[model samples]
Target: MIDTAASLSRFKRKTPRRVIWKRQGLAFLFLAPGLILFLLMIWYPTVQTVLFSFQNVGLTGSKGWVGLNNFDRMFGDPQFIIAWRNSIVFVLLSLIMGLAVPIVLALMINEMRRFASVFQLIVYLPALIPSAVGLLIWRLIYQPEQTGILNSMLKLVGLPPQLWLSDPNLAKPLIIVIMTWLSAGGSTLIYLSALREIPVEFLEAAELDGFSPFQRVWYVVLPLISSRIQIMLVLQIIIVAQVFTEPFILTQGGPASATMTPVLEIYNAAFVNSDFGLASAWSVSMLVVLSIFSVIYVWLRREDTGMN
Candidate 1:
């Protein structure tokens, strides 16, 4: 019989270096298109934005050096300050809704034996709708006049119809509620998947040990899925920090700019005000803040994991 292992070793030893070079080069050739497109579409614009933030960009396509003037103006503007503060509030409201609700819903769905798939489908149905469509749906439901769904319900109940999203105090929270309804389903599905991944043997062992249901989840299930939870939390922060479309499409940062957010301000600066440099400054500030916060969060998680 031929020695297959020795024959393979001999073949490997006999292979020419040019063949190896050709194979490696082919791999790089496949990667080249993606790399080139990324540079052109994403990376090049980012670099341009950062560089542009330092200059005075004019309506006539003129540009001049303006050392920190953009940043100074951004800080001094009251609307800019309101937008930044609102952005922070937006982040907090997202965490408040995003953290516990999805996890609880996932746990409930996981425990359900009958109708589990039906329940999952219901929860995730909103996520299937495009975000813009979802927002528009909510806008119609929350429309100020008595024609709105909620207002009509109040009319039936003999309760006076009141402003929903138009109310300043209610606007931000209501928008967050809309986002939570749309997004929580996706997060719940992710958590449900994580729960499904738990070993059957581990649960069996926990049961045999006389551990109660909550005990098993608290000690075994939660620790197993903790990493996913942390990741979701971090993602929520990053996403909410740049929230634009919710306020943009629904409220237009309205009710005295109560719902104003940094990204919306950036939009107004660039398009509405035609101040490209100021818009670039806002973009750079968001990048810097988010980058710093992400680094700190990862470091803390690493320390908790004893990988620091």
Candidate 2:
């Protein structure tokens, strides 16, 4: 009897260990495919990019290892400076338009007691359009000639037609406008969702305390949605810093490299100039900038989780 009792206790303890091991095995089994895909798709390319940055790769293959020669060439290039400056300007413009406009739209949409879905659909419609198609449409609209859609509108308003994408000064800002028009809807939806999550009681309490609509929004609503604002700000900065497609399709870094951006520079180096090594170095530099923002994103996420 004593032996049986001791054996039963041992069995009970062993069963839980076996169950835990089984669960762990199953968890790993479920995670294996995703982990393998991540390694192949993300990690492998990242490693290759870093390695290629140090080598003089061409159409044939790598000429040989060139140490930091690719990086030296990239930094010394005048276009590189122009691209970096343009990227910074794009980021600032995106912050002004992309960040504030969405919040305002979201707030206005949130107050609608009717036709809210219609409003949402209208706002988000542009986002549903293919990026290439949208850029093409905007390209035509930004044509320098008087027959261009925007220029035609200016004519109707008795205003002078202006060169948009063709003008070095206007090209970058026009791109930003197109970007905001294309992107603001999704951001507006996100902000609206965040705004909805704010407890009704908080707003009611603020109202009872004699808060005006503006005061309530400024004091109560903004604070609650501030985290989302931070997240969107960082994301916009990262994205605008890598502005490529719009400039590629619209300006092609032309009109004195006014709308040139880092990613565009990278693309030009690799495909246009057939200098893969220099392209990879430029990519690595961009990666460093993006990684800093990525770290901030992760830290902000953790802080938000802790606060919750």
Q: Give candidates' CA RMSD values in order.
A: 5.5, 2.5
lDDT by residue for model 2 over 1-308, one digit each (tens)?
99999999999989999999999999999999999999999999899999999999999988889999998999899888888889899999888767799899999999997977789888999988887799998898788896899999999999999988888888888888999999999999999999999999999999999999999999999999998999989988888898899989988988888888889888988999999999999999999889999888878788767853
Model 1: per-residue lDDT, tens digit, 144-168?
8968889999999899988998999
Each candidate's clash count: 0, 0
Query: Model 2: which ten-residue window has the lowest total lDDT?
Result: 299-308
Which residue pairs clash within candidate 2? Answer: none
Index of the highest-lDDT prediction: 2
- TM-score for each candidate, following the candidate numbering: 0.86, 0.91
lDDT of 2 at 87: 89
> Following a full C-alpha superposition, what root-mean-square deviation does model 2 have from the true structure?
2.5
Candidate 1: C-alpha RMSD after superposition: 5.5
Top model number, TM-score:
2
Cα lDDT listed for each candidate: 0.90, 0.91
